[model samples]
Target chain A: MEMTMCGIVGLFLKKEDLRPRLGDLLTDMLITMTDRGPDSAGIAIYGDEAPGLKMTIQSETPDETFAGLGDALTVAVGAPVPLRVADTHAVLILPEGTEAAARAFMTEKGIRVMGTGHAMEIFKEVGLPKDVAARFGVRGMGGSHGIGHTRMATESAVTTLGAHPFSTGDDQCLVHNGSLSNHNHLRRSLTQKGFPPSTENDTEVAACYISSRLAEGASLGEALEGTLDDLDGFFTFVVGTKTGFGVVRDPIACKPAVMAETDDYVAFGSEYRAFANLPGIEDARVWEPEPATVYFWER
Target chain B: MRTIDMATTPLRDLNSTLQAAAASGEGQWEIVNPKGSHAVAVGLDGPIAVTIKGSTGYYCAGMNKAAKIHVTGSVGPGVAENMMSGHVIIEGDASQYAGATGHGGLLVIKGNASSRCGISMKGIDIVVHGNIGHMSAFMAQSGNLVVLGDAGDALGDSLYEARLFVRGSVKSLGADCVEKEMRPEHVEILRDLLDRSGAEAKPEEFKRYGSARQLYNFHVDNAGAY
Candidate 1:
């Protein structure tokens, strides 16, 4: 069987001063893995939380879709809504308790919500890593932690929705490397449990699976550990929450994964090259992640 | 010494340069800043010595012949896969299928090796100083696999003719694989392989494993085993 290789990278800064370099370092890491996936790329950045909730939305026709969207949303919710447009995506900041109202409005307007959270802002597109990073100006943004993925679309179509860093929970996202064997079955089960997956991508199912586990009062570590038993197939997943970064591989560990940690930060990559050029990497403790073991760091 | 810097040069150019050097019978090459590139120093036929300074991605030093390759860092899946002849040494851990279906070579891993270390091997000699993952030597036709540390589940499934030696515990044996007596001849072979691969484990500390010879031909008595 031919495996569709993808690339996953994550960085959690342990030092406050290094926060400004997160996007720059992550961009280099994602671009180094361009050969691993050529179809699409996505990144989720965890930055400062505004006074309200931020929802990222994407559109095929941004000019028509985003025109006067802020005023229209403000009118619908009877609250001031601020919208920031980036190439094909827009970030809408709404009051704390207005997520459901905003989501309903988006559904009626046919605008696709990519992710919604207090701290996370996601940007993804169907293009090379370099172009996608440029499209969103990822290199200029600053964050404390972030996760990125380059997709080589095997299970789903090559579209913005199919890109990774799939967010199924507030302030949470997941990027996966290998395919799931029982995703179709698990997808139906998850849908019945009220965590309905929206994409045909198996990785979306995995994201929702983790989100549902967390919703059941499982810690991030416990949720990742559950994957070893419930998720059947080879996978190396890098999951990020508002305050933690976690990594886990399948029991067989058919995919490639390596991690490096320094006093300044902890990093995960499909291969070592992704973090090889990061600051203070020369003295970092680099090792391959043990199979079926969950490694996570929380701030 | 010829040096190829992956930081400044493209992968294709580096591979073509190595191919040209091999054609001229030149030896002693060094790859600086490999940066996890895949398929480095592959398909070399001449007796050359290549040292990769950093880690590499999948299929590094693959399909090699008459060359000695050394990687200072770890390697990804299928390292030395389908190799015909030569010595490939990894200073760090190796990913899955370390020496899959290699016809001939001496591949040594100083650190642990992931699943399928010597799958379908056809005459290659592999030595791992550390543990190996599951399904190792599966469907192995002919070769020698030496594991100084423990082996994971289903070791040597559907094995054929290949000799296996493990110094540590095996979680479980495969359908057609079982423990075999370590005769003086087997001891001699294990010692030779250990010496060639530079493994420090003594031959006397090892135990031999091989096919049970029941699955060679279809028989109703062995149908359940299959």
Candidate 2:
């Protein structure tokens, strides 16, 4: 398996004052774990919410795909749809009640939609995590919470589409560090349930699973707990909602996971080494997350 | 005192320096800013003391013949694995499969140890002041595992020969593993282990577990357990 199989990191800020530094801190943590996986990397930031909606899209040829995209959306929405470009991904600020039309417009133009929400913006590409992060200026972006993955690609190809932080619902994303033995079967059932995963990536099936659960009114903790029974394989999932960060590991927990929480933030890493540079980490309550347990933090 | 700063020096230099230390060399060495690096002081055959000021990643002190190594922070997977003869202490928790397949040594963890703490251990003496995770001591052939707190699921599954001492309740026992009477001799061994590891639990309050030796010969009827 050429795998994006290791190095998962997340940071959830409890102190609102640290929001501006979330990306910088998470970037440092992500870069520190470079040795775990180097095939591809991705990040999902629950940053400041725009007035209407934020839809992030990625393309192989950004110069042609992104040019005039904002102007075209503005004409279609009958309002200015502000755009921000970072590397191969671009975020479009859509006007209220225009998501369906904009979705159709982008689809007709054959655009790859990454995620949609007011606060969540995702960036992923096929490269080393440090280089990917630098290309997107992840160090300068500000957010209240974010999760990142550096994949090694064991079960699938090392393509941008196969990278993690899969977003199946607005403001919700997931990063995984293990493979699923029953992803094909699970994906079939999920597709039947209207949560068809867009990629062959196993992690995307899990992301859709969470989104499907939340759409059915299951709480974040309940959705995470559901994973233990329905999913079969080794996994350490760090999920992010608009205002929440949740974690769960398989009952076996063969894949490594560690967490540290302080008065300011809650953090997760596949190893303690990822937390070495966080401020006040020496005083943080660092511990190993228990197997088959769901740990959630909301601000 | 010799101080090695890993932030400025690569891990190869640190390990080579320690591995090259003369067997007669007896002095104190300190490592700073380990930043969760792996194999910090592996394959040491000297008589010296090294203190790591921070936490470490995988295989902190593997195949150690001599040299006492201590860590002030938690460690990742397989800490002190296959140690020959020495003392390795972790002030914080240890990740998975610590001290696996060791020939001889004493591994002490003051905090909890994750899954399979001493799987397939040969002759290492491990005393954890905190709880140990699931499937620990599985198929362990020899040596002793002492836990002060509870053990997770399937303790000593398919075990062999290794003696297990737990002061707290066991979640469940694995196949062919059973609780044994803590005879005076067992208590003496436990006492010695507690004393050496500086753990303060009373030997009288503990229970000993070992293999039933039913699967030793691998009969067809016992094949299911394997």
Off by over 4 Å in 1: A1-3, A280-283, B23-26, B217-226
lDDT of 1 by residue, B40-103 (tens): 9888887888999978888999999878999998888899999899899998889889999999
Q: State TM-scores per candidate.
A: 0.92, 0.97
**Model 2 TM-score, 2 decimals:** 0.97
* Cα TM-score of candidate 1: 0.92
Per DockQ, the best of the predicted structures is 2
User: Candidate 1, after superposition: displacement of residue B141 in Å?
Assistant: 2.2
- Chain A TM-score of each model, in the order shown? 0.97, 0.97
lDDT of 2 by residue, A42-112 (tens): 99998898998999999899999999988898888789999999999999988899899889987898888
DockQ score of each predicted structure, in the order shown: 0.48, 0.79
